[model samples]
Target: MPNSSEHPCRITIGDDGPLLVEGPVEVTCADGTVAVSDRFVVALCMCRRSRMYPWCDTSHRRRTQPGEKSRRDTG
Candidate 1:
């Protein structure tokens, strides 16, 4: 079987933030790695700007200084 989500999960998407998943949840990365969280809720990084890769640390909220361009703005 193809390696992908086979079951359903309740995920909440933000306009410019991480995906919120109610925990405890288990996640499998594209690299064949896995991560889990037993917290009441989990924030999965969508911007990939998090130091906590796979998990969000509100890094997406970081603002670039004047004259500095952000990655998302470049695309």
Candidate 2:
């Protein structure tokens, strides 16, 4: 059940990846470009490497570079 006093938003930190947020969420960039999502849940990138800005596409689970280490999944 959800609490009515709070906005319909929540964030969950991934073990080795993005921050998952319950939405609809609206992201506005520095240039004033806005991105909107009505998804039930949205993954926001933490590694700054996602092809889709303001959204996670599992890019954080991959190696940072060739020969680099990959992140381990703890959950």
Candidate 3:
């Protein structure tokens, strides 16, 4: 895992998709709702099609069909 003092949480990009986040982490939604779990390690969905919000449900794999890059580049 890449080490960075600025970001205490450790995040790894998985080969199959989903961001694997480990250690102290907090997730906040646009509606001011927050999800915090201690030693929080979980797979988060990069694709916005999850029925279970904020978590990966393997929806990305289906979404990224032929001619799709499975890229969710947001700024």
Candidate 3 lDDT over residue span 18-71, tens digit each: 888884556897788787655457777787788776777778864446666756
Task: Please write out the lDDT profile of model 1 over residues 1-75, one tens digit for every residue.
Answer: 112477445679979899998788778988988998888779999998889878999999968887797676765
Stretch of 10 with least lDDT, candidate 3: 66-75
Could you estimate the TM-score for every candidate?
0.68, 0.68, 0.57
Candidate 3's C-alpha runs over 4 A off are 1-8, 63-75
Q: What is the lDDT of residue 11 in candidate 3?
A: 72
Compute the lDDT of residue 49 as modeled in candidate 3.
80
List the lowest-lDDT window of 10 residues for candidate 2: 1-10
lDDT (0-100) at residue 56 of candidate 2? 81
Sorted on lDDT, highest at the top, how do the candidates line up?
A: 1, 2, 3
**What are the Cα lDDT values of the candidates?**
0.82, 0.76, 0.71
What's model 3's overall lDDT? 0.71
| Backbone clashes (count) for model 1 | 0
- At residue 65, candidate 3 shows an lDDT of 60
Better by TM-score, candidate 3 or 1: 1
